[model samples]
Target: MAVLEATNPAFEQFVRDTVLNMPAARHLGFEFGRIAPGDVEIIQPYREELTQHDGFVQGGVLGSLADFAAGCAAGTLLPPGWVNMTIDYTVKILAPAKGEKLVARGRVVKAGPVMTVAAADVYSADGAEETLCATAFVTMRNIRAARS
Candidate 1:
């Protein structure tokens, strides 16, 4: 696969701003990690409230992180002032997420004018080890945001 680079010089800032302004992302305390043209990483710190009965991170939270990460990856390839929204997504849980935090690595699979395909791998991170917990494939629709 060919490596993808960001066309927008302010892509990092754009993704940061977009994520920061989102209520769910903010509530989940999502942190920005790597931000590239066609790749992005989002980190979610573990909280008791976000865990399931067995103290593992909830599946819904994992899916949400994957969706956000994948959508942001596609958004990085969009033109300035353009944003992408998740039209559809599928996630598979492979293992229980038991760790200090979760890291989601997202990459664009294909980018087009109106739609984009992306995928993400979610990992449960301990002090120095990480375990793959989930994977997701996402489809996004690109749209120009209304200017204020």
Candidate 2:
């Protein structure tokens, strides 16, 4: 995989301040694994509350992880003071997310002035093994942040 570096020197901090600080992300305990231009990785530690009756991580949780990772990846490519919002996303759960943690790797497919397309692959990590659990494609609308 080609690694893309962010033009913004503070992009990592920007992601932490905007993405990781969101209420839902904070509540779900999502953390940054990696953040770069057009790429990102988010980690969600396994929690009992996030699991379904069968003890596997819920589909909704997986979808949320994929969405956040992809959106953040798109955000990394935005110009300074710009942000991206998820307009649409589709997630497919392929396996039971039974593991110690979940890692979502997201990469931008294409970026434009007003829109960006991204994709994410979610994996369930158990010790040294990782299983592909879900995948997602996301579309984001790029917009300038409104001054407060």
Question: Can you give the TM-score per candidate against the true fold?
Answer: 0.97, 0.95
Highest-scoring model, lDDT: 1
Which residue pairs overlap in candidate 1's backbone? 6-37
lDDT of 1 by residue, 1-148 (tens): 8877777889889989988899998899989899888999999999999998999999999999999999999988888888888999999999999899999999999999999999999999999899999999999999989899
For 1-148, candidate 2 gives per-residue lDDT tens digits of: 6566676678878877898668899899989898888889999999999998878999999999999999999888877898889999999999999899999999999888899999999999999899999999999999989998
**Which ten contiguous residues of candidate 1 have the minimum total lDDT?**
1-10
**Which segments of model 2 are wrong by more than 4 Å?**
1-5
Backbone collisions counted per model: 1, 0
Query: Residue 85 in model 2: shift from native, Å?
Result: 0.6
Sequence-dependent TM-score of model 1: 0.97
Error of 2 at 94 (Å): 0.6
